[model samples]
Target: MTAAPALAPAALRVRGVTKSFGDLAVLRGVDLEVARGSILALLGSNGAGKTTLVRILATLLAADAGTAEVDGHDVAAEAPQVRESLSLTGQFAAVDEVLTGRENLILVARLRHLPRPAAVADAMLERFALTAAGRRRAGTYSGGMRRRLDIAMSLVGDPPVIVLDEPTTGLDPQSRLEVWRTIRELATGGTTVLLTTQHLDEAEQLADRIAILHEGRIVHTGTLAELRALLPAAPVEMVQKQPSLEDVFLALIGHDGPPATAPSGPTAQETAS
Candidate 1:
């Protein structure tokens, strides 16, 4: 009798993740989970320790006292497998400006030891709509195109999970939308994504579920509708204050610590550097 194939674990799983640098605590016992092929937007402002949390999940930085797993592999114990299962794109696109778009993709493919790097790059260029710009130096590409190419490079090995921290930070609205469409397509292909962004509308647009991180803790997490359900029933005068999400965030989270260390929430790596 043939044994049934084992079930794939949750695409991303994190529990009690805490990170501190000197006197500053960056993440305070964060607990979260993301299912396979879903997009979870981690919404937080500039000093909310979002980048610190991302680094921990990607194995780029270790947590002080907690465990995290990617694709069922423990992040700390199985760093190699965890990294292989996920690709990370930080606030800025990690592409070589001097290299042509094709060269950039091929370089990453080779780095990953994928066979036929040229073929892999070509496929990725096509997949990301960069085929027309394949031979152009990445620096010459527009903001959106460069970002797409960066993402294409990350996809060269088809990692099952992708971590994007502020992927649309500096893009025009149209460029932002273009990236949004690309993200949507990736999820459709069964790729799991954990995206960190401060933009409320972006969260509404791209996430299957939204998690709001405040002062090193997840204050709330749920589907857009589910999150909306947390609000008091509408009738402006009845509630008194405005119904903005900022209001809701503060309301749900309560008045916590002073939004983490100020001036853009530096991670331990940043401070050590």
Candidate 2:
């Protein structure tokens, strides 16, 4: 008898993916994979091509060369299937300010052709802790509320993969923590999440695996401890105390010391950077 086949594809896969704009090359032969129900964080400074790579995977921008797949569907050739498998939340909230939080989710559900759109909307509001604010117009919602509503709307399609590009930007400490909890819950619910963020602490807090993008290529990829091993030994003076997450991050990225902390709560979960 033939051997049993594997049941599911890698949640995401990319091979030598490249993108360019005239003389400027944004992605250079990028390769990575993410398993189902896990979180992979893509870390980079501004212009490191994190967003460009995400756009290619999301089918918002076509790659100039190489290939990508979402749940085994080729992003370029099977664009519709790729889109059907993934939901993208960009840096800015994408909900309609004029609509109530509930209405916003219902509209998204209806657009996705889900039956019982109102029911789906209500469920999402409750899941995101927006049930109490469901009736308020989104225009009057705080930044955090709008962000939560935006993410809830993304789930209306119930895709298997979620792509978040700087999803926590501009959120207050409590709001950031709330978003972090929501992200963790998504992974716990068996959804694959690919996140791009500049916050090193955020990546350390939540990523199962982390990839660093620099100069249009993936410079390194591994679990936090593995990445830390790539760094040179700290000076004896600096080693008098146990190194912090920021130390590992700075060491790997070749920075001198920790950057200024954002006005945020403690790291949501601890892991080596």
Candidate 3:
């Protein structure tokens, strides 16, 4: 795809995207928009069709109805072009276990036909802070390191749009934080990101906006503050301010960055139908 999105004020646009299998419907009618260089979290629960919708946008699956576009390329008609404009990192780390971390990066670089794949791989390894583990088999790396390497590989071509589906689902607290930091850095560097998550705190911490997908439709769309306004503040009680788990976790780990404002729960709770 062309770099039109960078200067054309483009966005990841989805309109009435729907899908189904036999009699079971997945995405009924979903719509969302992630602006250029910003992060939008598609908040939902299991069976919410978030993955199905993502697959449609990624051109891995065809939609029964509606359309999706990125950087002026239609997902159906201009699939190849749309692909050029986007990068996808799924729910799990898509790394080669047998390959070393550096080798994994080099493999992706070569697939993208980047010049001097070794140099590109070296840069990626250093960027993800995996230089020391560059020679280690990816399967031997810690969960956080493996996730970082996966993300690093995804960014090789610097696709203007990226879709990450529950990137930190099974990670430990520290590893989750590391992946969170990486995602924030991605948006800060001007890549439009669309990520799906069940965690409310994740949406609060990462997204510029949140779209709560429920029963196959977007029931609400807004920033954390806006969504929080939907529910009245917790009675403004003069009660003790107990530190949250996230607060405790960060304090114990000394992690630097904005702490998530949301309490732990499925993101669907942040909004209602």
Query: TM-score for each prediction?
Result: 0.83, 0.84, 0.88
lDDT for position 96 in model 3: 97
Worst 10 residues of 1 by lDDT: 264-273
- Candidate 2 vs candidate 3, TM-score winner: 3
Candidate 2: worst-modelled 10 consecutive residues by lDDT: 234-243
Cα deviation of 218 in candidate 2 (Å)? 0.6
Give the per-residue lDDT of model 1 (tens digit) for 1-273. 999998767888889999999999989999989899999999988878899988988898999988899998999999999989999998888899999999998899989999999999999999999899999999999898988988888787899999998999898645665788799999999999999998887888789999999999999999999998897665422222234454455456663422211223322222111
Q: Write the per-residue lDDT of candidate 3 for residues 127-169, one digit (tens) a residue.
A: 8889999999999988989999999999998789889999997
lDDT of 2 by residue, 167-214 (tens): 999986556766887899999999999999999989988899999999
What would the TM-score be for candidate 1 when compared with the true structure? 0.83
Error of 3 at 238 (Å): 2.2
Winner by TM-score between candidate 3 and candidate 1: 3
Clashing pairs in 3: none
Task: Tell me the lDDT of model 2 at 170.
Answer: 92
